[model samples]
Target: MKTALLLSGGMDSIALAWWKRPELAFTVDYGQLAATAEISASAAICSALDIPHTVLRFDAKALGSGDMAGTAPDPNAPASDWWPYRNQLLVTLVAMKAVATGVQRLWLGTVASDGIHKDGTPEFFENINRLLSHQEGGIVVEAPAIGLRTADLIRQSDIPRSMLAWAHSCHKADVPCCHCRGCNKHFETLQELDADVATGD
Candidate 1:
């Protein structure tokens, strides 16, 4: 079946692209603070991997709250970077394009660490999968690394550092505001990976 990935140009998604080598990749510029860097990274990786890349632009910054939107966190936000229904919106947008492109499967970059958000949970994927499957295209949504952490996914994918270097995980800015949660996670994941290597794990 034809497959496509929601390549967010973050470590998890970039590693996934290397591992799965999906036929196509989609990067959405949904008015996130790091949209430019994310798109650039995604495009670079796609070009290197010879995978077709498509970018979908939808400006929803007004609906967004938190670091990603360069705004205050929502009262109900579970984290500083939380954006309400972001995963749902992204999936809906990607599926709209994927279905038209004859894609049978759509992969998300969600990892175990993302479980802090309800949308990143398995139940969300199940429900969304059901919702999509019930529709005309029957597009399946899957998170291949949902059970793994970022470091583990990177290791399992065996993605070369050269390609992995294209990841951009700054939630606050294209240039990477190191104080943001996203940047912290990116740095932490790299440390974990390095520690594993140093220990011969």
Candidate 2:
């Protein structure tokens, strides 16, 4: 069975990729987020797993791009979280890619704790999956972390500790802005994971 992953090189997505390696990865460049670490880290994860990777480019903001596109970034907050329906569009693109690659299963990193988008709702995923399935050629979207907390994802996965450091959580490019909510969330996830690991979990 063929599997595809929606990789953004962020901590959550990266963790999903590492957990499901050997499955090809799909990343998009929709003129939205410009963090180059996405390129490097995604490539590294793909290479490490020997899984083929593709970068698709689309003009995401061409449509009425409102707060979703230009949602001002807070220097002290998460710029990545402000994208306009980014997850929805990303999943749409993932469905397109799945059709092209003859892969029906698309795995994403939507943890129950990922409240930033749709509050990590099952209805959200079901809505998307429902539409895709009704399309001429159907694709299935699955979020393994549906009921999982960020800490649980890290604890259950076999991702290495070293690579964990490279998991980008910042919304900006170059260096990580530790103050952002995205970064803070990942930091919390790591902290919880480390605690679990220390306690022999």
Candidate 3:
């Protein structure tokens, strides 16, 4: 089946890309603070992997809240980086583009830890999958690493450190702030991977 990945240039997504090697990849610039860096990183990896990469641009900053939008977090935000319905919006947008390309499956970068947000849960994927499948395109959305942690996904993907280093996980800027949740996760995942290697895991 033809598959396409929502490549965000974050550790999780990058690892998923390397592991799945989808036929195509889509990077959406929804007016996020790190859109430029994310696009650059994603393009570089896609080039190296010889996967066709398409960038979809849509300005939704007015609809966003939290670190990614450079705005205050929504009152109901579950995390500092929360953007309401972000995953839903992104999945919908990607599916819109992917369906036209005859893509039968759309992959997300969500991992187990992301379940802190409702959208990142398995039920969310199942619900969204049903919603999308009920539509004309019948595209299925899946997150293969949803059951695993970031470090585990990295190990399973067996991505080279050099390639993985190209990921840009800063949620607040093109250059990593190192203080944001995204940056924290990036560093933590790397440390975990290093620890595993050192212990021969």
Candidate 4:
């Protein structure tokens, strides 16, 4: 059975892909807060795993008309972390890819630590799968990271820390800010497990 994984090339997504058995990697290049850098990192991650990967370009700017497409960061949002309906749209795109690619199982890397959800509740694979099932295709979005913390994911996957050296975790900056929500959250996850990541220690 063929499986498709939504790899964002970040720690969580990379871990998800590395944790799973050999499968195809499906990464969405949605006009993210960051651009080619994220996609480049994601490609490298998948390549290292020797998995077939597909890059899908999603124009969120044209699709998101809601609060998530904020031209500016919300006071509530961490700097450069502005984009609405991103999760939903990404999952939706994954489902479509699954249908077209003949992939039966789908995976994502979402975790409980994703406090950036518009609802304050991270929509793990369960929620997205439920909604996706209501659609026509039989694709299911599975977020193995939902129950596991980032630390757990890192402990489980074989991807090296060096692979993460260039991930664009910062929203506007070219590299990790180490203070932004994404970067801080990543740091916290590694800290929880005492794993060395972006930090030297």
Candidate 5:
């Protein structure tokens, strides 16, 4: 259907990229501390997979909270690395771009564990899809990995460990710090699946 994926250069997203193999991928730098690493990783994966890739740049740092923005995770934050409707914001941006390029479907990397965040729920995707579908282009928002955890998706997709190496999961550092929540999940998932993770820049 001429799909596009919102590739975040993280484990789940990378797995989804290999699983769906969309025609194109989009990486947005909404002022995250790890934007540079994320974009580079995403671009490299896209190039290797022979998928067209693009980076959408903007400064949403003022709207961000927690480690992603160089601040402590707020005790009352909506979620770790919370950025105030981050998925919603990214979806809107990608939808606009996708519609312009004749893309009919847009995919996100949300996984089962991400349900803790309101925006990661199935209802959110359904609602967002409805909103976008009502528009002129009818670009649909779908989260193909919402039913599986990171480890499950990785194992199920059978994505090569070498290609999965292109993902950068640390929220605070260009090179993975291996201590943050994101990095912890990435490493833990690889360990659980008994996959050798490629580290370092």
Candidate 6:
């Protein structure tokens, strides 16, 4: 199947890109605090991989909450970094783009750690895939690393350190703040794999 990956410029997605080497990749700028950094890192990685990269720019700052939006998460919020229906929105957007390009499948980077989120669960993917299968394009959504831990996926992908060095995980900074949950998990994943964490310039 002709496949494309949703590249988020994070460790798991980077590893997925390297392992699958998809025909193309999409990095959406959905107005997150890390959008600039994500686009930069994703572009760099795509260049290195010789994969076509597209940036879908949409200002959804109004929909974002918590650390990712530079606002404290609401105490009543279901998850700290939750944006209401974010994964569903993202998948829908990418699928719209994918259909135009004749992509049969779209890959998400959701790993085992992401299971905590309702939208990241296997059931969610299954339902979403069923929904897409009914659409005109028959675009399938797949999370190949959903069963693997971050470190395990990294080990399995064996992505080059040079390319991985460009992956950005901080939710609050253009460069890694090393304080956010994303950054912390990234560091821990690297340590677990005995890999060097890149110090972005």
Candidate 4 Cα outliers beyond 4 Å, as residue runs: 62-70, 75-82, 115-124, 190-201
Residue-level lDDT tens digits of model 4 in 63-127: 54322243556565543554656777777887787788777778777776665564224444557
Clashing pairs in 3: none
lDDT of 5 at 142: 92
Q: Which digits, one per residue and each the tens of the lDDT, describe model 1 over residues 91-198?
A: 999999999999999999999999999999999999999999899999999999999989989999998888888899999999978889999999998898889889
Q: Which portions of model 1 show Cα errors greater than 4 Å?
A: none
Q: What lDDT is reached at residue 29 by model 6?
A: 89
Task: List the global CA lDDT of all models.
Answer: 0.94, 0.71, 0.95, 0.67, 0.89, 0.89
Q: Which candidate, 1 or 6, has the higher lDDT?
A: 1
Candidate 4 residue 62 Cα shift, in angstroms, is 5.7
Better of 4 and 6 by TM-score: 6
Model 1 residue 4 lDDT score? 97
When 1 and 4 are scored with lDDT, the better candidate is 1
Question: How many angstroms is residue 105 displaced in model 6 relative to the true structure, after the best TM-score fit?
Answer: 0.5
lDDT of 3 at 30: 98
Q: Put down candidate 3 lDDT per residue, 1-201, tens digits, no spaces.
A: 999999999999999999989999999999999999999999989999999999999999999999999999888899988998999999999999999999999999999999999999999999999999899989999999999999999999999999999999999999999999999999998998889889998
Task: Give candidate 3 misplaced runs (Cα > 4 Å).
Answer: none
* Candidate 6 lDDT tens digits, 18-63: 9989999999988899999999999998998899999998888888
Cα-based TM-score, every candidate:
0.98, 0.84, 0.98, 0.79, 0.93, 0.94
Tens digits of lDDT, candidate 5, 1-201 = 999999999999989999889999999999999999999999988988899999999889888888899987779887677767889999988887878899999999999988888898999998999999898998988999999999889877788889888889998989888898899888888777664433321
For candidate 4, which ten residues in a row score worst on lDDT?
63-72
Residue 124, model 1: Cα distance from true site in angstroms: 0.3
Please list the residue runs of candidate 2 whose C-alpha ends up more than 4 Å from where it truly belongs after superposition.
Answer: 61-70, 73-80, 197-200
Total backbone collisions for each predicted model: 0, 1, 0, 1, 0, 0
- Per-residue C-alpha lDDT of model 2 across residues 75-164, encoded as one tens digit per residue: 543334556466788888867877887886888888886655572578888988887778866777778777877666766777887876
Against the true structure, candidate 3 reaches a TM-score of 0.98
